[model samples]
Target: MFDNFKKNSERYRDYEVIAKFIRLAIPARWRPIGYLEHLVRSRTGGRIPKGPFAGMRYIHTAFGSAYVPKLLGIYERELNPFIEQACALNCPLIVDVGAAEGYYAIGMALRNPDARVIAFEMEQKGRAALKEMAELNNVTSRVEIRARCKRPDLAQILATSDRALILCDAEGDEETLLDPETIPMLAHTHLLVEVHEFVSAGIAERVMKRFAATHKIRRIWQEDRHRSDLPFATLGTTLLPRFYLDWSVSEWRPERMSWLWMEPRTVNAPAA
Candidate 1:
């Protein structure tokens, strides 16, 4: 009976009533369920599906595109372990660039309530949604949401930090953020940045070389191989396109870096 319930729950349409009940019972605290609902709705456009969170309406917008529950699930799963390890290391500051809806930022903050998280979202709608989600998760106190992704002022803020974790997903502007000068501002920071194929033409190699000269680089998450010629598809079909590269300052060359790759979690997998 319980197995049947579990199976049925994973079926999107079959869980509509239950999702509605959860939404009504805990409006703000239902992000996981709400995210599932959003994912199901977006994947099928309100049609029935064979996955969880079946009947909820998925908002259609740029920001909404990043809210796919399956993708978020993958991110959370892949990120949590690294975050736990980082938290254990006594890292205090975390900067999240391209923090759509605050998922990563909120999750990091929730994980380490004492840590200060500065989250950056370039889109107004995304920033607003991030604020709402942060409030929903009751992590507003720990997260600082900003409307800009790149700012000299922000770089200055980071310059004062010696121990920090920086996550950058600034779409195509990643090269701009990897400036050697900026590296000093983030000297003591560990970085997790998403490298876009197009924007990173030769930039990825350049950044890597420069970072190697000054830090220890570890690849924490890599997306499946992506082809630029592929057509855009639905969230379910398109998948998250960026790769998460982890970096730390080198011990031998405290000024040089080394890097490795971490694979991304499979999308649309069973919840843990």
Candidate 2:
């Protein structure tokens, strides 16, 4: 019974009803989350403080996840090393699907100046913020912002480059977008896909099956944040109470989340 209630509560939050309520009920930058954001911004000067994308300027808000962890550079700390390594490769094409406010898109752009970054965001506000960040970072020439990423659009983009790095967090749409058979170029690309099991049941299993033949798949689980994960945790805990610090780093995910990092194993990956 407790599990059921917890699951329902998670669902309510994921559907944005709870998150929306929290934002509306509480006015901006005063207490709780808003105050937490203020604290982080003052410390980092509105830039990511200590991660792969350190010194990278961010917008006033993050579209998803709490902005505090993002400023601390530990939002998805699990993927930090992998993302850094991928950026170091400086692949000619870097595609960010379901890019919200250009976190990965703009960060990767700053990391790999030579690469062309294409960001696919459906929401108008997100798209606008992405553009603003790109300009702020002065990578507008290398960054291409686009609306909803359909399979054909992805296929066409991937076809242009022999090697590409694709970071897809399209909610549950990743199942349909990352198929190697339909999008042949995907077989040649390195894909970091967030498999949304909560949003799409059995989607994680299905995503692996689609790419197993062409790539080496590594499953990465997103674990809960610890106090140690935050660079400021050691310094700030003494100043602020524990509860306030906890609210700053919490991502508040709805369910068990995992990502499939699929890298092509062969010079010519079969599009079968």
Best by TM-score: 2
Per-structure clash totals for the candidates = 13, 0
* lDDT per residue as tens, model 1, 67-177: 333232432233445555665544567888888876567666766767788998887888887887677667778888887766584576566555667767676576787
- What's the lDDT for residue 139 in model 1? 74
Q: Which segments of candidate 2 are over 4 A away from where they belong?
A: 1-26, 227-241, 268-272
Top lDDT prediction, candidate number: 2
lDDT (Cα atoms) of all candidates against the true structure: 0.51, 0.80
In terms of TM-score, how similar is model 2 to the real structure?
Answer: 0.86
Cα displacement (angstroms), candidate 2, residue 121, comes to 0.2
Error of 1 at 59 (Å): 10
